[model samples]
Target: MTSPASPYVGRFAPSPSGPLHLGSVVAALASWLDARAHGGRWLVRMEDVDGPRTVPGADQVILAQLAALGMTSDDDVIYQSSRHAVYEAALARLTAMGLIYPCGCTRREIADSAPIHAVSGERPYPGTCRTGLQPGRGPRAWRVRMPAGVHCFEDRWLGRQCQDVAREVGDIVLRRADGQWAYQLAVVIDDADQGVTDIVRGADLLSSTARQQVLGQTLGLPLPRVMHVPLIVDTDGRKLSKQNGAPAVDTQAPLVALQAAWTALGFAPLPDASTAAAFLTQATDAWRLRWHIHPCSA
Candidate 1:
C-alpha cells in the first residue's frame, strides 16, 4: 500500500445535518480504508452547503467521532459553506457556455407531470423551463442544459453502468430554489479541484455517477474513479438515513463499532485487536489484500 506516484486521493464527505450513524460510518470507513490501502490522501469534507439542513455544531461533533474511531483527515478539512464564490464562478462559466437556464417549475408540478411509473418514481423534470419559464413565472432555480446522449461509466465494485442524463435525469438543477448550490454540481467541482483520483462510498449514489461524469465532461474536468459499496438498509428495506431515524454510532466501544462498520462493508470480522488504531491497521492490510492493490496500478 505504498504507491509513490499514484497521487490517489479519497474523501469521506458527510453532510453535517446530524451525527455519524452506522450507515455513515460504513461509507466513511470504506473511503478511509481505500485511501490507506492505496497509500493515498484521505480527506474529510463538511458538506454544509445546504444552510437550512445543516445543524449547528454538528461538524465539530462529527469530527470528534471520526477521530475517536481512529480515522482523521490527512489535511485541513474543507467546508462547502466557505466556497460560495467558487460555485458562483462555475455557474458563470456554464452560463457563458449557454448551458445554464433559469427554471420556474416547482417540485410538485414536475412530479405531477411526470409518469408515475418512472424509475424510482422520480420525476425527470419534464424540461418545462428549458426554453423559457412560463409567462409571468419567476426563476425559482437554475438548471444545467443536459446534452443529448447516454453517459456511461464503469464502477469498481458494481461493474458497468450507464444513464441518459438528458432523457433520464433531464436538466439538473445547479442552484436550488432556496439559492443554495446543488449536490451534483458542487461535489463534481470539489472533487476536481481537490484532485481526488478515487471516490468510494455507499451504493445509493451509483445512479448519480453517470450524471456526474456528464457534468465533468461538460465542465472539462477529469472524472475520478468510482467504487460504490453496498448500502445499509433498515428492516423495511429502505436506506438508513437521518430522515429515516437511523441511530447514532455507538462510540463507547470504539473497537466494536469499527468492526461492525467493517462488517457492514461486506467483510468478515477483522483479526482480533484491542484498540481502534490496531483494528484499523489490520483492516487496512485485509482491504489491500482483498482488493489486490498494486502500487503501480493504483
Candidate 2:
C-alpha cells in the first residue's frame, strides 16, 4: 500500500487506433475525477506501441476532445512509441535474470494444442516452448516464465481477488511475433516509470491486473492502487469499443456527454451546473465522498 504522505499520481492512457467514443469518455472522466478528488497529478499517454494499428492524427483528436470536455492533463502527453529504448532496457534486465525465453508458437498452433473453453474462453498457454523448442521450430516471440502459486491483490471497488498465472495464464509474451511490444509488458513498465499511484479504468481489464502484478513483482516495481469501474456496454451486452462501431463523442455538446458519463458512473444528477467545468467540480467532490467508502478501506 502507498503511504498517505506519498502524493497520488494518475494517468489516462488511450490507444490512438480510433477516436474517443462514449465508452472512452467514461473511462477518461472516471480517472480524471479520481485524480482531482485526491488532489493528484493527472497525466495522459498515447498508447501507440502497435505501430501498424495507430491511425494518423488520432492522438490530436483525442486530446482535443479531452480539452473540449474540460479534462486536461497536468503534464505533456507521453507517447509510447518514443519509449522503445526504455522497454529494451527492461527486457534486457529480464533476459539477464533468465526470466525471459524465446518462443516460436503461433496462435493457431497454441489453440490447437490447448483448446480454450467456450464458457471461460481463457487461452492459457500450455508451456509449449518452456523447454527447448522443437528441432524444426524457430523463435518468433519472447515470453516470460510465470511462477507457480496464487497471486492476490485488493481492488478498490472489486475487493479481494486472486489468480494463478502459471496454471491459468501460463507464460505470457513480452514481445510479439509481429515485433510489437506486448500491452502487458509496456503497461507495467510505463506505470512504474510515470510514478502512477492510482489506476482507475473499465472493468474489462480487471483480469489483466494479476498478470501485471506478477510482472511488477518480478521487476521490483511498486504496485499501484487499482480501481476497476463498470464497463459501458451496448445493447448486445458487449463492451462498447471502436471495433463494435461505437461512435465518437459529440464534442459540440461536451457537457451533455459529460453528464451521461457521470450518470453511467452511478452518480446522481448534477446540481444544476451552469458549465461543464462547474459540473466537473461538483463531480469531483462527489467522487471524494465515494472514494472514502471504497472496498480497499474495508
Candidate 3:
C-alpha cells in the first residue's frame, strides 16, 4: 500500500551546544520560510541528545531568537533529553527485530580496522563490531546492523543518491560507549514521532540522509522529503560552525540575514522585502523557479 498523505508539518531541530550562529540562522530561516509559505505548521525541537555538550539556557536563547525574528512554531518545543523513554522504546523495537547489537569498537579500534569507508571526507566505520563478541559484554555500545544491498533516495535538491549502508555506514552505534544516544538513532525516532513530512537543512548533512532513510524504513516511518540548501562558509571556505566561532545573529537584522541566506542559495531577494513574511514570499517564488529550471535528478 502507498504511504499516507504527507502532513504539512515541518520542523527545525537544532542542538544547544552553543548559540545559534549565522549558519544556524540560515537553516532556521529557510525552514521557517518554506513552512510558512506553504501554510504549514513549523515546529522547533531542541536536539540536546549529548547532555555533556549542551549548555544550560541555550534552548531558551534559541527560542527567543526565533521569536525575535518573527518565526513562530505551531507547538511547544520538544527537547530530546526529556524524551529518554521514547528513545528507549525505539531501541527496544530495533533490539527485538535483531537489528541492534552491542559494539565494543572504540575510535582507535575502528581506525585500525582493515576495510573502511570515508563519509563527509573523514573516517568511516570499518564494521569492526558488526559481528564480534557476546551480547552482555561490559561497557559495550549498541549498534544498528545495516543490511546489505544498495539503498537509494531522491533528494528534493541533491537528486538521486544510492549507497549500500552495510558497506558504507557499517554497523553504526545507536548508543555511544559513553552511554549517550547516537544522533542517527535519536533523529530518526524524533522525526517519526513528530510527524515530520519534510526535512530542509544545510548541505553539510547530505551524506547522513541516506542512512536516515534506511533507519526510517526499519522503523516503518514514511520517508520524508529531503532538501539540502547550500551551507554558509567562513573566509577560509570552511563550513561555519560553533567551533569556528561564528557569531550569532542580532535578530534585529534578521531581514538582512535572511536576504544573505537566500542569496547563498543562488536566489535573489526582493528589494522592498523588509518583513519576514514578505521575504519568505519572495524566497518561495525563487525556490520554485530554481527547482523548475534544475529539477532533482532523482
Better of 2 and 3 by lDDT: 2
Q: Which stretches of candidate 1 lie over 4 Å from their true place?
A: 1-6, 116-121, 295-298
TM-score of model number 3: 0.90
Question: What is the lDDT for 57 in model 3?
Answer: 93
For model 1, residues 80-163, the per-residue Cα lDDT tens digits are 999999899999999999999999998888878976435534567788888998999999999999899877777889998878
C-alpha TM-scores of all predictions = 0.95, 0.95, 0.90
lDDT of 2 by residue, 1-298 (tens): 5555568888999999889998999899999998888878999999999899899999999999999999998998999999999999999999999989889898898889886744335888898888878789888899999999999989988999888877778899999767799999999999999999989999889889999999999999999999898889999999999989999999999889999899898888795887999999898888888877343332
Q: For residues 52-135, could you state the per-residue lDDT of candidate 3 as single tens digits?
A: 989999888888888877777799899999888988899999999988877776677777773445543545666665676646
Clashing pairs in 3: none
Off by over 4 Å in 2: 117-120, 293-298
Query: Clash number for model 3?
Result: 0
Evaluate model 3: give its lDDT: 0.78
Candidate 3 weakest lDDT stretch, 10 residues? 289-298
Instruction: State each model's C-alpha RMSD to the native.
Output: 2.4, 2.5, 3.6
Residue ranges of candidate 3 with Cα displaced over 4 Å: 1-4, 114-122, 134-137, 288-298
